[model samples]
Target: MSDARAQAPETEIVDRNLTLEIARITERAAIAAAGWRGKGDEMRADQAAVEAMHDALTRIDFKGKVVIGEMRGSEKLGLDEEVGTGRGPDIDVAVDPLEGVTGCAKDLPDALSVLAFAERGGLLHVPDAYMEKIAIGPGYPEGIVDLDKSPRENIETLAKAKGVPITEIVACVLDRPRHASLLAELREIGVAVKLLPDGDIAAVIHAANSDDTGIDIYMGSGGAPEGVLAAVAMRCIGGQMQGRLILDTAAKREQAERIGIPDLKAKYSAEDMAHGDVLFAATGVTKGSLLNGVKILPRKIVTSSVVMRSWSKTTRWITAEHQR
Candidate 1:
Protein backbone atom coordinates (compact mmCIF):
# COMPACT_ATOMS: atom_id res chain seq x y z
CA MET A 1 0.00 0.00 0.00
CA SER A 2 1.07 3.58 -0.61
CA ASP A 3 2.17 5.68 2.39
CA ALA A 4 -0.90 7.93 2.19
CA ARG A 5 -3.33 5.02 2.02
CA ALA A 6 -1.54 3.20 4.83
CA GLN A 7 -1.79 6.27 7.04
CA ALA A 8 -5.15 7.84 6.29
CA PRO A 9 -8.00 8.20 3.83
CA GLU A 10 -7.04 11.86 3.40
CA THR A 11 -3.46 13.09 3.51
CA GLU A 12 -4.28 16.50 4.99
CA ILE A 13 -5.49 15.36 8.39
CA VAL A 14 -2.19 16.08 10.12
CA ASP A 15 -1.12 19.27 8.45
CA ARG A 16 1.14 21.86 10.06
CA ASN A 17 -1.82 23.68 11.59
CA LEU A 18 -2.92 20.59 13.49
CA THR A 19 0.66 20.02 14.67
CA LEU A 20 0.81 23.54 16.12
CA GLU A 21 -2.61 23.10 17.65
CA ILE A 22 -1.36 20.03 19.54
CA ALA A 23 1.56 22.03 20.84
CA ARG A 24 -0.86 24.62 22.19
CA ILE A 25 -2.70 21.85 23.99
CA THR A 26 0.47 20.70 25.72
CA GLU A 27 1.42 24.32 26.53
CA ARG A 28 -1.85 24.94 28.34
CA ALA A 29 -1.36 21.82 30.44
CA ALA A 30 2.21 22.80 31.24
CA ILE A 31 1.22 26.29 32.35
CA ALA A 32 -1.54 24.95 34.54
CA ALA A 33 0.84 22.46 36.18
CA ALA A 34 3.51 25.14 36.55
CA GLY A 35 1.12 27.03 38.86
CA TRP A 36 0.92 24.02 41.15
CA ARG A 37 4.65 23.41 41.19
CA GLY A 38 6.29 22.92 44.61
CA LYS A 39 2.87 22.89 46.27
CA GLY A 40 3.56 19.33 47.53
CA ASP A 41 0.15 18.25 46.37
CA GLU A 42 0.42 15.91 43.40
CA MET A 43 -3.30 15.39 43.03
CA ARG A 44 -4.07 19.10 42.73
CA ALA A 45 -1.24 19.64 40.27
CA ASP A 46 -2.38 16.74 38.09
CA GLN A 47 -5.96 17.93 38.27
CA ALA A 48 -4.94 21.38 37.07
CA ALA A 49 -3.06 19.91 34.11
CA VAL A 50 -5.93 17.59 33.13
CA GLU A 51 -8.50 20.38 33.25
CA ALA A 52 -6.30 22.67 31.21
CA MET A 53 -5.43 20.01 28.66
CA HIS A 54 -9.02 18.85 28.22
CA ASP A 55 -10.12 22.45 27.72
CA ALA A 56 -7.47 22.99 25.09
CA LEU A 57 -8.29 19.69 23.39
CA THR A 58 -11.97 20.54 23.14
CA ARG A 59 -11.12 23.63 21.10
CA ILE A 60 -9.14 21.79 18.43
CA ASP A 61 -10.87 21.31 15.06
CA PHE A 62 -10.87 17.49 14.80
CA LYS A 63 -12.79 14.42 15.82
CA GLY A 64 -10.41 12.71 18.27
CA LYS A 65 -10.74 9.54 20.29
CA VAL A 66 -8.60 8.90 23.35
CA VAL A 67 -7.13 5.41 23.06
CA ILE A 68 -4.53 5.66 25.82
CA GLY A 69 -4.90 7.97 28.79
CA GLU A 70 -5.03 8.23 32.57
CA MET A 71 -4.98 4.86 34.27
CA ARG A 72 -6.29 6.06 37.58
CA GLY A 73 -10.06 6.04 37.75
CA SER A 74 -10.32 9.64 38.98
CA GLU A 75 -8.44 11.39 36.20
CA LYS A 76 -10.28 13.81 33.93
CA LEU A 77 -9.27 12.40 30.51
CA GLY A 78 -10.58 8.90 30.77
CA LEU A 79 -9.96 6.07 28.35
CA ASP A 80 -12.21 6.12 25.24
CA GLU A 81 -13.25 9.73 25.83
CA GLU A 82 -14.04 11.72 22.68
CA VAL A 83 -12.43 15.15 22.49
CA GLY A 84 -11.99 17.93 19.95
CA THR A 85 -14.48 20.08 18.04
CA GLY A 86 -16.93 18.32 15.71
CA ARG A 87 -15.54 19.87 12.55
CA GLY A 88 -12.53 17.85 11.46
CA PRO A 89 -11.42 14.39 10.37
CA ASP A 90 -11.51 11.50 12.81
CA ILE A 91 -8.18 10.75 14.58
CA ASP A 92 -6.69 8.85 17.50
CA VAL A 93 -5.16 10.67 20.47
CA ALA A 94 -3.03 9.37 23.32
CA VAL A 95 -2.37 11.76 26.16
CA ASP A 96 -0.58 12.21 29.45
CA PRO A 97 -1.89 15.52 30.73
CA LEU A 98 0.63 15.33 33.56
CA GLU A 99 3.34 12.76 33.01
CA GLY A 100 5.33 13.19 36.21
CA VAL A 101 3.03 14.02 39.05
CA THR A 102 5.71 13.44 41.67
CA GLY A 103 8.21 15.57 39.82
CA CYS A 104 5.71 18.43 39.59
CA ALA A 105 4.74 18.23 43.25
CA LYS A 106 8.34 18.28 44.44
CA ASP A 107 9.67 20.76 41.89
CA LEU A 108 11.86 18.11 40.39
CA PRO A 109 12.96 18.05 36.79
CA ASP A 110 11.45 16.23 33.77
CA ALA A 111 7.74 16.73 34.41
CA LEU A 112 5.88 17.27 31.13
CA SER A 113 2.51 17.50 29.42
CA VAL A 114 2.54 15.16 26.44
CA LEU A 115 0.21 13.85 23.71
CA ALA A 116 0.31 12.08 20.34
CA PHE A 117 -1.98 12.15 17.27
CA ALA A 118 -2.48 9.60 14.50
CA GLU A 119 -5.10 8.58 12.01
CA ARG A 120 -7.77 6.22 13.29
CA GLY A 121 -6.37 2.74 14.12
CA GLY A 122 -2.84 4.02 13.64
CA LEU A 123 -1.77 3.88 17.29
CA LEU A 124 -1.74 0.74 19.41
CA HIS A 125 -4.52 0.49 21.97
CA VAL A 126 -2.18 0.02 24.90
CA PRO A 127 -3.84 -0.70 28.21
CA ASP A 128 -2.79 0.92 31.48
CA ALA A 129 -0.01 -1.27 32.92
CA TYR A 130 3.70 -1.47 33.53
CA MET A 131 5.83 -1.73 30.39
CA GLU A 132 9.44 -2.81 30.01
CA LYS A 133 11.18 -0.46 27.59
CA ILE A 134 14.61 -0.02 26.04
CA ALA A 135 15.39 2.78 23.58
CA ILE A 136 18.26 4.43 21.72
CA GLY A 137 18.82 7.55 19.63
CA PRO A 138 18.61 7.80 15.82
CA GLY A 139 21.19 6.64 13.28
CA TYR A 140 21.88 3.30 14.90
CA PRO A 141 21.34 -0.11 13.41
CA GLU A 142 17.73 -1.25 13.38
CA GLY A 143 18.30 -4.19 15.74
CA ILE A 144 21.07 -2.62 17.83
CA VAL A 145 19.02 -3.01 20.98
CA ASP A 146 16.41 -5.59 21.84
CA LEU A 147 14.09 -6.12 24.81
CA ASP A 148 15.07 -9.77 25.01
CA LYS A 149 18.76 -8.93 25.39
CA SER A 150 20.40 -8.48 28.75
CA PRO A 151 21.34 -4.92 29.70
CA ARG A 152 25.05 -5.69 29.65
CA GLU A 153 24.83 -7.27 26.21
CA ASN A 154 22.70 -4.43 24.84
CA ILE A 155 25.11 -1.77 26.13
CA GLU A 156 28.15 -3.63 24.77
CA THR A 157 26.48 -3.89 21.36
CA LEU A 158 25.42 -0.23 21.40
CA ALA A 159 28.90 0.96 22.39
CA LYS A 160 30.50 -1.08 19.62
CA ALA A 161 28.00 0.27 17.09
CA LYS A 162 28.66 3.86 18.18
CA GLY A 163 32.45 3.26 18.11
CA VAL A 164 32.61 4.18 21.79
CA PRO A 165 33.89 2.27 24.79
CA ILE A 166 31.43 0.65 27.18
CA THR A 167 32.46 3.07 29.92
CA GLU A 168 31.47 6.07 27.81
CA ILE A 169 27.87 5.10 27.22
CA VAL A 170 25.34 6.74 29.58
CA ALA A 171 22.17 4.83 30.40
CA CYS A 172 19.08 6.44 31.85
CA VAL A 173 16.85 4.50 34.24
CA LEU A 174 14.00 5.47 36.53
CA ASP A 175 14.88 5.74 40.23
CA ARG A 176 12.62 3.11 41.62
CA PRO A 177 13.16 0.05 43.77
CA ARG A 178 12.25 -2.20 40.87
CA HIS A 179 15.31 -0.91 39.01
CA ALA A 180 17.79 -1.72 41.76
CA SER A 181 19.09 -4.81 40.01
CA LEU A 182 18.99 -3.14 36.61
CA LEU A 183 21.02 -0.19 37.87
CA ALA A 184 23.52 -2.44 39.58
CA GLU A 185 23.93 -4.52 36.45
CA LEU A 186 24.61 -1.45 34.31
CA ARG A 187 27.12 -0.12 36.82
CA GLU A 188 28.84 -3.50 37.04
CA ILE A 189 29.20 -3.50 33.27
CA GLY A 190 31.13 -0.20 33.57
CA VAL A 191 28.26 1.77 32.01
CA ALA A 192 27.33 5.06 33.64
CA VAL A 193 23.72 5.09 34.79
CA LYS A 194 21.67 8.22 35.35
CA LEU A 195 18.73 7.81 37.69
CA LEU A 196 15.66 9.94 37.26
CA PRO A 197 13.06 10.49 39.97
CA ASP A 198 10.15 10.50 37.53
CA GLY A 199 9.35 10.82 33.81
CA ASP A 200 10.66 7.98 31.68
CA ILE A 201 9.10 9.67 28.63
CA ALA A 202 11.73 12.40 28.89
CA ALA A 203 14.39 9.78 29.46
CA VAL A 204 13.51 7.86 26.30
CA ILE A 205 13.23 11.07 24.28
CA HIS A 206 16.63 12.04 25.63
CA ALA A 207 17.99 8.73 24.47
CA ALA A 208 16.52 9.51 21.06
CA ASN A 209 18.75 12.61 20.86
CA SER A 210 21.83 11.64 22.80
CA ASP A 211 23.96 14.40 21.28
CA ASP A 212 21.76 17.06 22.86
CA THR A 213 20.27 15.24 25.86
CA GLY A 214 23.36 13.20 26.94
CA ILE A 215 21.31 10.00 27.31
CA ASP A 216 22.58 7.12 25.22
CA ILE A 217 20.06 4.53 26.34
CA TYR A 218 16.86 4.26 28.41
CA MET A 219 15.77 1.09 30.19
CA GLY A 220 13.28 -0.04 32.83
CA SER A 221 9.54 -0.25 33.27
CA GLY A 222 7.23 2.74 33.46
CA GLY A 223 3.64 3.67 32.67
CA ALA A 224 2.49 1.94 29.47
CA PRO A 225 0.72 5.08 28.24
CA GLU A 226 3.97 7.04 28.48
CA GLY A 227 5.73 4.26 26.61
CA VAL A 228 3.28 4.70 23.72
CA LEU A 229 3.83 8.46 23.83
CA ALA A 230 7.59 8.00 23.73
CA ALA A 231 7.22 5.60 20.83
CA VAL A 232 5.47 8.36 18.90
CA ALA A 233 8.38 10.77 19.43
CA MET A 234 10.94 8.11 18.59
CA ARG A 235 9.11 7.41 15.35
CA CYS A 236 9.32 11.09 14.37
CA ILE A 237 13.01 11.30 15.28
CA GLY A 238 14.14 8.09 13.57
CA GLY A 239 15.00 6.20 16.72
CA GLN A 240 14.46 2.66 18.02
CA MET A 241 12.30 1.47 20.90
CA GLN A 242 10.72 -1.79 22.06
CA GLY A 243 8.22 -2.39 24.82
CA ARG A 244 6.38 -5.32 26.43
CA LEU A 245 3.46 -4.88 28.78
CA ILE A 246 3.63 -6.72 32.12
CA LEU A 247 0.21 -8.21 32.62
CA ASP A 248 0.90 -9.63 36.06
CA THR A 249 -2.70 -9.89 37.19
CA ALA A 250 -5.80 -11.41 35.74
CA ALA A 251 -7.53 -8.05 35.86
CA LYS A 252 -4.70 -6.45 33.88
CA ARG A 253 -4.86 -9.21 31.28
CA GLU A 254 -8.61 -8.77 31.01
CA GLN A 255 -8.13 -5.02 30.62
CA ALA A 256 -5.67 -5.58 27.79
CA GLU A 257 -8.11 -7.85 26.03
CA ARG A 258 -10.82 -5.21 26.33
CA ILE A 259 -8.49 -2.76 24.57
CA GLY A 260 -8.14 -5.24 21.66
CA ILE A 261 -4.82 -6.71 22.63
CA PRO A 262 -4.96 -10.38 21.76
CA ASP A 263 -1.62 -11.65 23.01
CA LEU A 264 -0.81 -11.05 26.61
CA LYS A 265 2.93 -11.38 26.01
CA ALA A 266 3.15 -9.34 22.85
CA LYS A 267 6.19 -7.11 22.37
CA TYR A 268 5.86 -3.76 20.63
CA SER A 269 8.28 -1.87 18.43
CA ALA A 270 8.22 1.88 17.82
CA GLU A 271 6.37 1.50 14.55
CA ASP A 272 4.07 -1.14 15.97
CA MET A 273 2.90 1.27 18.66
CA ALA A 274 2.60 4.35 16.44
CA HIS A 275 2.63 3.83 12.71
CA GLY A 276 2.20 5.99 9.63
CA ASP A 277 2.32 9.75 10.00
CA VAL A 278 2.32 10.52 13.68
CA LEU A 279 2.35 13.94 15.33
CA PHE A 280 3.76 14.24 18.85
CA ALA A 281 3.86 17.30 21.09
CA ALA A 282 5.31 17.91 24.54
CA THR A 283 5.69 20.94 26.84
CA GLY A 284 8.00 21.01 29.81
CA VAL A 285 6.23 21.52 33.11
CA THR A 286 9.46 21.64 35.11
CA LYS A 287 13.17 21.95 34.43
CA GLY A 288 14.23 18.75 32.71
CA SER A 289 16.88 17.17 30.52
CA LEU A 290 14.73 17.22 27.38
CA LEU A 291 12.84 20.56 27.73
CA ASN A 292 12.93 23.74 29.77
CA GLY A 293 10.41 24.47 32.48
CA VAL A 294 7.52 26.84 31.89
CA LYS A 295 8.24 30.45 32.93
CA ILE A 296 5.44 32.52 34.41
CA LEU A 297 5.73 36.28 34.59
CA PRO A 298 3.43 38.96 35.93
CA ARG A 299 1.40 39.11 32.74
CA LYS A 300 2.73 36.47 30.39
CA ILE A 301 3.51 32.77 30.43
CA VAL A 302 6.39 31.40 28.40
CA THR A 303 6.48 27.72 27.39
CA SER A 304 8.96 25.55 25.50
CA SER A 305 7.48 22.84 23.32
CA VAL A 306 8.67 20.38 20.66
CA VAL A 307 6.31 19.28 17.90
CA MET A 308 7.20 16.46 15.54
CA ARG A 309 5.71 14.83 12.44
CA SER A 310 6.85 11.43 11.21
CA TRP A 311 5.88 11.81 7.55
CA SER A 312 7.78 15.06 7.12
CA LYS A 313 10.52 14.12 9.61
CA THR A 314 9.97 17.64 10.91
CA THR A 315 10.90 18.52 14.47
CA ARG A 316 10.00 22.07 15.45
CA TRP A 317 10.88 23.79 18.69
CA ILE A 318 8.35 26.46 19.63
CA THR A 319 8.53 29.07 22.35
CA ALA A 320 5.20 30.78 22.84
CA GLU A 321 4.56 33.79 25.08
CA HIS A 322 0.96 33.93 26.22
CA GLN A 323 -0.55 36.98 27.84
CA ARG A 324 -2.58 36.14 30.94
Candidate 2:
Protein backbone atom coordinates (compact mmCIF):
# COMPACT_ATOMS: atom_id res chain seq x y z
CA MET A 1 0.00 0.00 0.00
CA SER A 2 1.16 3.51 -0.76
CA ASP A 3 1.38 6.10 2.00
CA ALA A 4 0.95 9.77 1.19
CA ARG A 5 3.38 10.64 3.98
CA ALA A 6 6.29 9.09 2.13
CA GLN A 7 6.44 12.17 -0.04
CA ALA A 8 7.62 14.22 2.90
CA PRO A 9 11.22 14.03 4.10
CA GLU A 10 11.53 11.14 6.54
CA THR A 11 15.28 11.33 7.06
CA GLU A 12 15.15 12.30 10.71
CA ILE A 13 12.99 10.52 13.29
CA VAL A 14 12.12 12.08 16.63
CA ASP A 15 13.64 10.05 19.43
CA ARG A 16 11.10 7.67 20.95
CA ASN A 17 12.38 8.39 24.48
CA LEU A 18 10.87 11.83 24.30
CA THR A 19 7.46 10.26 24.99
CA LEU A 20 7.93 10.82 28.70
CA GLU A 21 8.85 14.44 28.11
CA ILE A 22 5.70 14.89 26.07
CA ALA A 23 3.67 13.34 28.89
CA ARG A 24 5.22 15.77 31.35
CA ILE A 25 4.23 18.71 29.18
CA THR A 26 0.61 17.55 29.03
CA GLU A 27 0.62 16.85 32.77
CA ARG A 28 1.74 20.39 33.46
CA ALA A 29 -1.04 21.72 31.27
CA ALA A 30 -3.65 19.46 32.89
CA ILE A 31 -2.62 20.31 36.46
CA ALA A 32 -2.70 23.99 35.61
CA ALA A 33 -6.16 23.67 34.12
CA ALA A 34 -7.34 21.66 37.13
CA GLY A 35 -6.93 24.67 39.40
CA TRP A 36 -9.46 26.65 37.41
CA ARG A 37 -11.89 23.81 36.96
CA GLY A 38 -15.32 24.73 38.36
CA LYS A 39 -14.34 28.38 38.57
CA GLY A 40 -16.72 29.18 35.68
CA ASP A 41 -14.00 30.94 33.74
CA GLU A 42 -13.03 29.29 30.47
CA MET A 43 -10.48 31.75 29.17
CA ARG A 44 -8.51 31.84 32.38
CA ALA A 45 -8.40 28.06 32.61
CA ASP A 46 -7.23 27.73 29.01
CA GLN A 47 -4.66 30.48 29.38
CA ALA A 48 -3.23 28.91 32.49
CA ALA A 49 -2.79 25.58 30.72
CA VAL A 50 -1.20 27.28 27.75
CA GLU A 51 1.25 29.13 29.92
CA ALA A 52 2.14 26.01 31.86
CA MET A 53 2.58 23.95 28.72
CA HIS A 54 4.60 26.69 27.07
CA ASP A 55 6.88 26.87 30.09
CA ALA A 56 7.27 23.10 30.11
CA LEU A 57 8.02 23.10 26.39
CA THR A 58 10.94 25.43 26.97
CA ARG A 59 12.47 22.93 29.35
CA ILE A 60 12.48 20.18 26.75
CA ASP A 61 15.40 19.59 24.35
CA PHE A 62 13.80 19.24 20.91
CA LYS A 63 12.75 22.18 18.76
CA GLY A 64 9.01 22.18 17.98
CA LYS A 65 6.73 24.21 15.77
CA VAL A 66 3.05 24.38 16.55
CA VAL A 67 1.16 23.20 13.52
CA ILE A 68 -2.06 23.21 15.50
CA GLY A 69 -2.65 24.99 18.78
CA GLU A 70 -4.61 27.84 20.28
CA MET A 71 -7.70 29.32 18.77
CA ARG A 72 -7.34 32.20 16.38
CA GLY A 73 -7.01 35.65 18.00
CA SER A 74 -5.88 34.11 21.29
CA GLU A 75 -2.11 34.02 20.66
CA LYS A 76 -1.93 31.14 23.12
CA LEU A 77 0.04 28.74 20.88
CA GLY A 78 -0.67 30.41 17.63
CA LEU A 79 -0.10 28.58 14.36
CA ASP A 80 3.65 29.14 13.97
CA GLU A 81 4.93 29.57 17.51
CA GLU A 82 8.25 27.81 18.01
CA VAL A 83 9.42 26.36 21.28
CA GLY A 84 12.17 24.36 23.00
CA THR A 85 15.94 25.02 23.10
CA GLY A 86 16.21 24.83 19.30
CA ARG A 87 19.12 22.44 19.79
CA GLY A 88 17.52 19.06 18.96
CA PRO A 89 15.65 17.59 16.02
CA ASP A 90 13.09 19.91 14.49
CA ILE A 91 9.57 18.45 14.80
CA ASP A 92 5.96 19.31 14.06
CA VAL A 93 3.58 19.63 17.01
CA ALA A 94 -0.16 19.81 17.57
CA VAL A 95 -1.44 20.68 20.98
CA ASP A 96 -4.64 21.48 22.81
CA PRO A 97 -3.63 23.08 26.08
CA LEU A 98 -7.19 22.58 27.27
CA GLU A 99 -9.60 20.63 25.09
CA GLY A 100 -12.84 20.95 27.04
CA VAL A 101 -12.80 24.58 28.13
CA THR A 102 -16.49 24.75 28.99
CA GLY A 103 -16.39 21.36 30.66
CA CYS A 104 -13.35 22.31 32.69
CA ALA A 105 -14.89 25.62 33.71
CA LYS A 106 -18.04 23.79 34.88
CA ASP A 107 -16.14 20.92 36.56
CA LEU A 108 -17.45 18.40 34.08
CA PRO A 109 -15.82 15.20 32.88
CA ASP A 110 -13.51 14.66 29.86
CA ALA A 111 -11.51 17.87 29.89
CA LEU A 112 -7.99 17.00 28.70
CA SER A 113 -4.61 18.50 27.88
CA VAL A 114 -3.22 16.79 24.79
CA LEU A 115 -0.27 17.11 22.42
CA ALA A 116 1.38 15.20 19.59
CA PHE A 117 4.92 15.34 18.17
CA ALA A 118 6.02 14.12 14.78
CA GLU A 119 9.08 14.32 12.59
CA ARG A 120 9.30 17.44 10.50
CA GLY A 121 6.44 17.60 7.99
CA GLY A 122 4.91 14.47 9.46
CA LEU A 123 1.60 15.96 10.60
CA LEU A 124 -0.87 17.92 8.55
CA HIS A 125 -1.32 21.64 9.13
CA VAL A 126 -5.02 21.94 9.79
CA PRO A 127 -6.85 25.23 10.09
CA ASP A 128 -8.81 26.12 13.21
CA ALA A 129 -12.19 25.19 11.79
CA TYR A 130 -14.84 22.53 12.06
CA MET A 131 -14.13 19.09 10.56
CA GLU A 132 -16.59 16.37 9.65
CA LYS A 133 -15.13 13.19 11.17
CA ILE A 134 -15.85 9.45 11.38
CA ALA A 135 -13.76 6.80 13.12
CA ILE A 136 -13.91 3.15 14.16
CA GLY A 137 -11.69 0.72 16.01
CA PRO A 138 -9.53 -1.91 14.33
CA GLY A 139 -10.33 -5.56 13.36
CA TYR A 140 -12.97 -4.67 10.80
CA PRO A 141 -12.52 -4.39 7.05
CA GLU A 142 -11.06 -1.14 5.86
CA GLY A 143 -13.46 1.66 4.99
CA ILE A 144 -16.30 0.32 7.14
CA VAL A 145 -17.50 3.84 7.98
CA ASP A 146 -17.02 6.82 5.68
CA LEU A 147 -17.45 10.55 6.14
CA ASP A 148 -19.44 10.84 2.94
CA LYS A 149 -22.03 8.27 4.00
CA SER A 150 -25.25 9.17 5.79
CA PRO A 151 -25.55 8.21 9.45
CA ARG A 152 -27.97 5.39 8.73
CA GLU A 153 -25.84 4.01 5.94
CA ASN A 154 -22.75 4.14 8.07
CA ILE A 155 -24.52 2.38 10.92
CA GLU A 156 -25.89 -0.32 8.64
CA THR A 157 -22.52 -0.85 7.00
CA LEU A 158 -20.75 -1.11 10.32
CA ALA A 159 -23.39 -3.49 11.64
CA LYS A 160 -22.94 -5.75 8.65
CA ALA A 161 -19.17 -5.59 8.92
CA LYS A 162 -19.27 -6.52 12.59
CA GLY A 163 -21.81 -9.28 11.90
CA VAL A 164 -24.17 -7.85 14.49
CA PRO A 165 -27.62 -6.36 14.52
CA ILE A 166 -27.96 -2.60 14.02
CA THR A 167 -29.01 -2.02 17.61
CA GLU A 168 -25.94 -3.81 18.95
CA ILE A 169 -23.45 -1.45 17.35
CA VAL A 170 -22.77 1.70 19.38
CA ALA A 171 -22.05 5.18 18.05
CA CYS A 172 -20.75 8.32 19.76
CA VAL A 173 -21.46 11.84 18.67
CA LEU A 174 -20.94 15.33 20.04
CA ASP A 175 -23.95 16.99 21.65
CA ARG A 176 -24.82 20.17 19.82
CA PRO A 177 -27.77 21.92 18.18
CA ARG A 178 -26.26 21.42 14.74
CA HIS A 179 -26.47 17.67 15.31
CA ALA A 180 -30.22 17.74 15.88
CA SER A 181 -30.87 16.14 12.52
CA LEU A 182 -27.95 13.75 12.91
CA LEU A 183 -29.25 12.68 16.30
CA ALA A 184 -32.71 12.11 14.91
CA GLU A 185 -31.38 9.97 12.10
CA LEU A 186 -29.29 7.80 14.43
CA ARG A 187 -32.26 7.25 16.72
CA GLU A 188 -34.45 6.54 13.73
CA ILE A 189 -32.10 3.70 12.81
CA GLY A 190 -32.50 2.11 16.27
CA VAL A 191 -28.77 2.23 17.03
CA ALA A 192 -27.36 3.14 20.41
CA VAL A 193 -25.87 6.65 20.62
CA LYS A 194 -23.59 8.25 23.20
CA LEU A 195 -23.65 12.03 23.13
CA LEU A 196 -20.68 13.84 24.63
CA PRO A 197 -21.08 17.42 25.80
CA ASP A 198 -17.51 18.22 24.71
CA GLY A 199 -14.12 16.63 24.03
CA ASP A 200 -14.78 14.58 20.94
CA ILE A 201 -11.05 13.76 21.00
CA ALA A 202 -11.69 11.43 23.93
CA ALA A 203 -14.68 9.98 22.12
CA VAL A 204 -12.52 9.28 19.09
CA ILE A 205 -9.91 7.60 21.28
CA HIS A 206 -12.64 5.51 22.84
CA ALA A 207 -13.82 4.44 19.41
CA ALA A 208 -10.29 3.34 18.52
CA ASN A 209 -10.18 1.14 21.61
CA SER A 210 -13.64 -0.37 21.24
CA ASP A 211 -12.84 -3.67 22.96
CA ASP A 212 -12.17 -1.82 26.18
CA THR A 213 -14.16 1.42 25.82
CA GLY A 214 -17.24 -0.23 24.26
CA ILE A 215 -17.48 2.59 21.74
CA ASP A 216 -17.58 0.89 18.35
CA ILE A 217 -17.72 4.11 16.36
CA TYR A 218 -17.33 7.88 16.63
CA MET A 219 -19.02 10.34 14.29
CA GLY A 220 -19.68 14.09 14.17
CA SER A 221 -18.12 17.48 13.60
CA GLY A 222 -15.35 18.89 15.79
CA GLY A 223 -12.38 21.25 15.74
CA ALA A 224 -10.00 20.60 12.87
CA PRO A 225 -7.01 20.79 15.21
CA GLU A 226 -8.44 18.11 17.49
CA GLY A 227 -9.36 16.01 14.51
CA VAL A 228 -5.74 16.04 13.38
CA LEU A 229 -4.61 15.28 16.90
CA ALA A 230 -7.02 12.35 17.08
CA ALA A 231 -5.76 11.06 13.77
CA VAL A 232 -2.21 11.20 15.07
CA ALA A 233 -3.23 9.19 18.12
CA MET A 234 -5.07 6.71 15.96
CA ARG A 235 -1.85 6.19 14.06
CA CYS A 236 -0.10 5.17 17.25
CA ILE A 237 -3.03 3.43 18.95
CA GLY A 238 -4.65 1.65 15.97
CA GLY A 239 -7.85 2.72 14.12
CA GLN A 240 -9.25 4.06 10.87
CA MET A 241 -10.66 7.55 10.46
CA GLN A 242 -11.55 10.16 7.85
CA GLY A 243 -12.03 13.90 8.11
CA ARG A 244 -12.93 16.85 5.90
CA LEU A 245 -12.76 20.45 6.96
CA ILE A 246 -16.08 22.33 6.99
CA LEU A 247 -14.99 25.35 5.01
CA ASP A 248 -18.32 27.15 5.15
CA THR A 249 -17.32 30.82 5.32
CA ALA A 250 -15.02 32.84 3.10
CA ALA A 251 -12.63 33.59 5.95
CA LYS A 252 -12.22 29.91 6.72
CA ARG A 253 -11.62 29.07 3.07
CA GLU A 254 -9.06 31.82 2.81
CA GLN A 255 -7.29 30.65 5.95
CA ALA A 256 -7.19 27.07 4.69
CA GLU A 257 -5.66 28.25 1.42
CA ARG A 258 -3.17 30.41 3.24
CA ILE A 259 -1.98 27.33 5.13
CA GLY A 260 -1.17 25.55 1.82
CA ILE A 261 -4.33 23.49 1.83
CA PRO A 262 -5.04 23.58 -1.87
CA ASP A 263 -7.91 21.13 -2.10
CA LEU A 264 -10.64 22.65 0.01
CA LYS A 265 -12.90 19.64 -0.58
CA ALA A 266 -10.33 16.94 0.08
CA LYS A 267 -11.12 14.15 2.52
CA TYR A 268 -8.10 13.13 4.61
CA SER A 269 -7.51 9.69 6.03
CA ALA A 270 -5.78 9.02 9.32
CA GLU A 271 -2.46 8.53 7.60
CA ASP A 272 -3.10 11.55 5.45
CA MET A 273 -3.59 13.74 8.49
CA ALA A 274 -0.61 12.35 10.43
CA HIS A 275 1.73 10.06 8.62
CA GLY A 276 4.72 7.93 9.58
CA ASP A 277 5.90 7.65 13.17
CA VAL A 278 4.42 9.96 15.78
CA LEU A 279 4.03 10.19 19.53
CA PHE A 280 0.88 11.35 21.33
CA ALA A 281 0.35 12.29 24.96
CA ALA A 282 -2.76 13.36 26.84
CA THR A 283 -3.50 14.05 30.52
CA GLY A 284 -6.87 14.19 32.20
CA VAL A 285 -7.91 17.53 33.67
CA THR A 286 -11.17 15.98 34.87
CA LYS A 287 -11.86 12.31 35.38
CA GLY A 288 -13.28 10.46 32.39
CA SER A 289 -13.22 7.03 30.77
CA LEU A 290 -9.82 7.59 29.18
CA LEU A 291 -7.90 8.75 32.28
CA ASN A 292 -8.33 9.86 35.87
CA GLY A 293 -8.66 13.52 36.77
CA VAL A 294 -5.80 15.42 38.39
CA LYS A 295 -5.87 14.83 42.17
CA ILE A 296 -4.81 17.62 44.51
CA LEU A 297 -3.54 16.15 47.74
CA PRO A 298 -2.46 17.64 51.05
CA ARG A 299 0.87 18.96 49.77
CA LYS A 300 1.13 17.46 46.31
CA ILE A 301 -0.71 17.22 43.00
CA VAL A 302 -1.06 13.88 41.19
CA THR A 303 -1.65 13.61 37.46
CA SER A 304 -2.41 10.70 35.09
CA SER A 305 -1.34 10.67 31.45
CA VAL A 306 -1.16 8.30 28.48
CA VAL A 307 1.63 8.41 25.93
CA MET A 308 1.65 6.42 22.71
CA ARG A 309 4.37 5.68 20.16
CA SER A 310 3.53 4.65 16.62
CA TRP A 311 6.87 3.12 15.77
CA SER A 312 6.72 0.64 18.63
CA LYS A 313 2.95 0.27 18.76
CA THR A 314 3.02 0.72 22.50
CA THR A 315 1.05 2.87 24.96
CA ARG A 316 2.41 4.09 28.29
CA TRP A 317 0.42 5.40 31.23
CA ILE A 318 2.34 7.61 33.61
CA THR A 319 1.38 9.02 37.01
CA ALA A 320 3.36 11.77 38.66
CA GLU A 321 3.20 13.67 41.93
CA HIS A 322 4.29 17.30 42.12
CA GLN A 323 4.77 19.18 45.36
CA ARG A 324 2.96 22.42 46.00
Off by over 4 Å in 2: 1-16
| Candidate 1: C-alpha RMSD after superposition | 2.6
- Can you write out model 2's per-residue Cα lDDT over 1-324, one digit (the tens) per residue? 246554644444444358778999999999999999999999999999999998998877878898887883566578889988887888888989999999999998899999999988998987779999999988888887888889989999989988999999888999999988988988988888988889988989999999988889998899999999999889988889999999999999999999999899999999999987898999999998899999999999999999998876789988899998
lDDT of every model, 2 decimals: 0.90, 0.89
Against the correct fold, how does model 2 do in TM-score? 0.95
Scored by Cα lDDT, where does model 2 land? 0.89
Clashes of each: 0, 0
Off by over 4 Å in 1: 1-10
Count of backbone collisions within predicted model 2:
0
Report how far residue 229 has shifted in candidate 1, in Å: 0.5
